[model samples]
Target chain A: MSLLSNSAVEKNMDLAPAPLKKEKVKMKKGLQLFLIALPFLILVFVFSYLPLYGWSYAFFNFRPGIPLSQSEFVGFQWFKSIISNPTQTAEVMRVMKNTLAISALGVITSVLPVTFAIFLTEIKASWYKRIVQVLTTLPNFISWVLVYSVAFAIFSTNNGLLNHVLTDLGIIDTGVNYLASDNHTWLSMCMWNVWKTLGWSAIMYLAAITNIDPELYEAAKVDGAGRFRRIWHITVPGLMSTYFVLLLLQIANFINNGMEQYYVFQNAINKDHIEVLDLYVYNIGMLGTNFSFATAISMLKSIVSVFLLFFANKMSKILRGESII
Target chain B: MAESILIKKKTKKEKENSRSTKGEIVFNFFNMAFFALITFICIFPFYYLFVNTISNNDLSSRGMVIFLPKGIHFTNYLQVLRLEGLGRAAIISLSRTLIGTILTVFGCALLGFIFTQKQMWGRKFWYRFVVITMYFNAGIIPWFIIMMNLKLTNNFLAYILPAVIQPFFVILVKTYIESIPAAIQESAELDGAGTMTVFFKIIMPLSKPILATITVFAAVNQWNSFIDTLFLMTDSKLYTLQFVLYRYMNQLSSLANIIRGSQGGSSISASIANMQTPTSVRMTVSMIIITPIILVYPIFQRFFVKGIIMGAVKG
Candidate 1:
C-alpha cells in the first residue's frame, strides 16, 4: 500500500525540478493541490468521519435534548445489554436470523443475473434484445416504495393479479395472502430483489462478455466448437473474475442488508421475518428513543462489517491476485 | 480498445457467415424461449400495473382484471394527480433532483479533475478520503444522531448537500478524465491557464459523456431516496413524493385491515372502497412515481451503461 501510494504521487505530477529547487517547487505544488482538494476533503470528513466519532455514544446513556457530556458514561453497559437481557438477546437473534436468511438467498441467486446476461447476449434479434434490456433495467431506477406497490398489485390477497389468475384457473377457491404470509419471507424477498436488480446487475456481466478476447471465440469456431462450447469455455471464464470480485464484495457486505426494501415490504404479520440488522437499529432507536443502546448495537455491526471487508479484501488478493481495497 | 472492438465485430460477422448445424438450431430455439420467458417475467408486473390501473374499479377490487384492462379509465391517474400535497411533494422531489444532481456532478467533476492532476499535493490522500466512506460508515443509529446533531433535519440542504461529496462518483469521474490525453491539460497549463480554468473550460467540455452519466445516477438517487426523508423530515411541508407515497400506502393498508377486522367478508370490500386511495389509484400512484424514469431511461441509458462499464472494469 505504501509503495502504491508513493508511486501514485510520483506519477501524478508532471513537473521534475532540479535538486536545488526541488523541495521549494514540490511544496508550492502541494499547497496548490491541497487548496483545490480542501472543500471536498472537509465535506467528507464531516459526513463520514464525524459519524464515526458519534459512535462514541455507544459508551454513554445518551438521551435526546441532553448533551453527551452531561449524560452518564457507562462503558460496556449497552453492549452487555444486547446479550445479557433476554428480550434484547431474542430481538437481536431474531434480527440476525432474518438478516442471514435474506443474505443467503441473495448470494444463492447471484448466479441468475450472470445467466441472464449470457442468455441475453445470444439473442439474434437486436430490437427485441434492446426492448428487453431497457424494460428490465427500468425497475432498477425506481424506489423500493414503488416496487412494493407493484408487488402488492400482483400479490395482494383481495385484488392481486396472481391470485386472480390462479382462482380463475380453478387453482384455489380464494386468494392466497402471499404478501401477508411470513412463511416464505426469505423466498419472497429474494424473488423481489432479483426482479428489481437482475437487469442492472446483468449489465456488468454483459459488459465483461463484450470485452472477451474475440480471437478465442474465432479459434474455437474454427475447431468446430458450437455456441454453447464457446460460451462455457470462453465467456464464462471471462466473467469469472468479474463475478468473483462482485461476490467477494457481497460477502464483505453480508451483514449490511439495507433497510429500504424490507422496510417498505414489512407488514405487522411479516415484520418478524422482514426486519434485518439495520432496520432493527432504526426501529429500536426510534421505538423508545433509546439512542445510546441502539448506537451500541449499530457500533458492533459496523465493526464486524469493516473487519469482514478487510478479510474479504485479503482473500480476494490472495485468491484472485487482485484487491478491491 | 477500438481496434479490438472492430476485430470482435469482424469475427462476429465471420461467424454469421457459416450455416448453422441442427444442434445449433435447437440451441438457438431453447435460448430464445428462455430469454422470452425471462423478458416476460421482467415486464409483466409493469404491464399488469398499467392495465389494472386503467381497468374498471369494481372488477379490479374483486381481483378479476387479471390479463387485460376491463375498461380504460383515466380517472385514477387524474384523481391521483389532484391528490392533496401531491403537487407540493412533487415540487420537493423535482427541485431536489435538479439541485442535487447539479451540485454532485459538478463537485465530482471538479474533484475528479483535481485528483488526476499530479501537481496537486497529497492527491492520493484526498482521493482515498472519500472512497473509504463508500465502504465504511458508523451505520444507521449513530449516523442518524450525527445528522440530528448537525441540525440537517427538516432542512432542504439535507437533501442537496451530502450528494456533492460522493466519493465513488468522484473516482469514476477521475477515471474518465484520466483517459483524456494528458497533453490537452498540459498544453493548457503551458498556455498560462490556471487549474480552475483548465477544468471548467477544457475538462468539463470533453467530459460531457461522463458528466451526463453521473448526473443521471445522482438524479435517480436523489429522486428515489425516501429513507432520508423518512428519517430526517418531521415536517410534512418537506415531504418528497416517495415519502408521501410510503405514508399513504401504510395508511391505506392499516385502515383496510381495521375495517376488515371489524366488518368482515363482503363489507370489507365496501370499507376498502370507501378508503381515500382505491386499488386503481394506488396502482396509478406507482405509475406516476415511475413514469418519468421509464420515459427518459432510454435516452440516458447509453450513458448509464457507458458509466457503469467504465467505472466497474477500471476499478
Candidate 2:
C-alpha cells in the first residue's frame, strides 16, 4: 500500500484488535482521538464537501442568494443538452478533440523522460551533469505567468528577438507572428511542456536508476556487454516498467489537461486551437458566468473521469500487481 | 560523483572485454554536441531575458541586445521598484507566504499526528473523509459561490484558511508520523502526558525533516499562487507581487499605467514618455518577480526532489 493515503495504509494492515478485556478504556481512547480529529473533519466537510452540495445548482436554475426550493428544478435538462443541443454538442466535440490531442502529445512525450534519465546516467562529468539538471529542473517551480513573460520576451511579434533575428537575416521581410497564429498550437505547446518538465519528469526515473542493483552492471560487464548494450539490455528494460506504470496513471487522467498554461497563452487568435475541455468549463463558468450550464458540463466530465480512473486502476492491478488508489 | 566514477571504472573493464571500435569516437562527439544543444535550449530563454532586462532600453527595445547586455542601465529596474503599490504588494506576498506556510504545516502535522494514533475511533472512515476529496470536487463555480457565501472574498484569511486543511500534506505527515516508534509515545503516555504534550514534546521534535520539507512546499505554493487572489481579491490593495507581475505581462495598458503612476516627479514622467514603450520595463518587473524564487531555490531543491520522487513524478 502507498503511504500517499492513510486509509489505504490502514486497510493494508490485517491485524484484528484484541477484544473484551479493556473495551471501556479502548472506547475512551477512541473518543479522544476522534475529538482531536473533529476540526479537520469539519474543515473538509465545509470546503471539500460543501461545494458538493452546491452541485445541486446544476439541477435547479441557480441564482445568487436564492433558495433551491424557490428555483425551477429542471431534471436532467442541462445534461440532456450535452447531447441534444447541436451547438453545445459541437462545442463539446471541439473541446474533447483538443483535450484528447493535447493529452496524446503529453503521453507520447512521457517516454522522453526515460530517455533523459538514461542519458543522465551516461554523463561522465559530475559538475556539468549537475548544472544541466539544476537548470532544467528549476523551470518546474516557476509559475506559468512568469513563464509567459519569458515566452513573450523572446517570441512576442512586436519588438521580439526572434522577429528581429529573422528579419535581419533576410529570411523574411516581415516578422512571423508565431504566438498569434493558430497554425502550430499543438506542437508549440507540446514542445513548451517538454522544455518545462523534462528534468522534473526524469527525476522518478533517476530514483529508479539508483535502485538498479549495481551488481547487475557488474554481471553484465562480466558477460562482455558494452555501454550501449548494457543501457539497452538492462537500463531500458528496468525503466520501461516504471514508465508503463506511470503511463497507465496518465491514461486514467486523460481528460485532465490542466487549463492554466492554455489560459495564459489563450487569445482571440489562438483560442480556437488551444481551448481544451477544462478550459472550456472554466471560461463558461468563470468568464461567461453561466454557472448552471458549466456545472452540468463539469459534472459529466467528473463522472467520466471517475469511471476512467476505475478502469485504469483495474488495468494497473492486472499489469503491476497492485492498484494505485 | 561516486556513481560516475564507479560507472567509468566499470566501462574501462568492459572495454577490455571487447575491443573499442574506431566508430565510437565519432558517435561520442555527436552525442556530446547533441547534449550541448539541449542545454542551450533549456537555459537560453532565461539568460536572454536577464540580458535584455539589464540592457539600455534603446538597445533592448529594438531587440539588439541578444547575445549579451550592452550599455547596461538600472533605469528600468528603478522604475519597476518605484511602481505604484509595488512595496505594498511585496508585503502582502511575503506575509501570506510566511503565515500561510506556517499555519498549513502545523495544522497538517497536527491532524496527521491524530490520524496516526492507530487506536483512533473510526480512523479509516475519517481518513477516507480527507482522502476522498483528492478524487472528487464540486467544480469551480460551486467553489466560487461557497467562497462568496463564506464572505471570504477580498479577505486575507481567504488565502490562509483555504490552504490550512490540505489533505495531501496531512497524509504525507501522517506517513512520517507512523514511522516513529510507538514506544516513545506510549512511554510518554505512561508518564501521564496528554496527547498535545506528547505531540509537541516528542513527535514534533522527531519529525523535523518532514516538517521542513512540508514548509518549503507550502511556502513555494503560497508564494507562487495568484489564482486565489485573481478569483477573490478584486480590491487593488490585496494584490500580491505575482498578480502585479501577471498584469504587467498581460495588459499593455497596465504597463503604461505603471509608468504613469510611478511618475516620480516631472523628470521621470518625461523620461517615461520619451521611452516610447515599457517592453524592457516589463521584462525588468518580471525579472524582479522571479528573482527571489531563483535565489532560494537551491536551498530547498533537495527537499523538492525528495517530494517529487515520493509523489511519483508524474508530469
TM-score of chain A of each: 0.88, 0.89
Clash counts per candidate, in order, are 2, 0
Q: Could you give candidate 2's per-residue lDDT for residues B3-116 as a string of tens digits?
A: 999999999967854556545566666666676787788778878888887777777787788898887766667667677878889899999999999889988999899999
Candidate 1 C-alpha RMSD relative to the actual structure: 8.0
Model 2 spans with C-alpha error above 4 angstroms:
A1-26, A63-70, B1-29, B264-276, B313-315
Q: Over 4 Å off in model 1, which ranges? A: A1-30, B1-20, B253-277
Give lDDT per model, in order: 0.83, 0.80
Per-residue lDDT of A1-325 in model 2, one digit per residue for the tens?
2233444334334323645545776688889988987877887898888877667879977665576679889888888988999998998998898899999999999999899888877776777777777777888877777778888887888888899999889998987777788987988888888988998888889889988889999999888788889999999988877887789878888988877788778888989879988789888887786778888877777778888888988998898787777
Native contacts conserved, per model: 0.71, 0.55
**What's the residue-level lDDT of B81 in candidate 1?**
58
Q: Considering the two chains of model 1, state its CAPRI-style docking category.
A: acceptable
C-alpha TM-score for every candidate? 0.88, 0.90
Candidate 1 lDDT tens digits, A137-212 = 8778889999988888888887777888898899899889888888888888989899889999999998888889
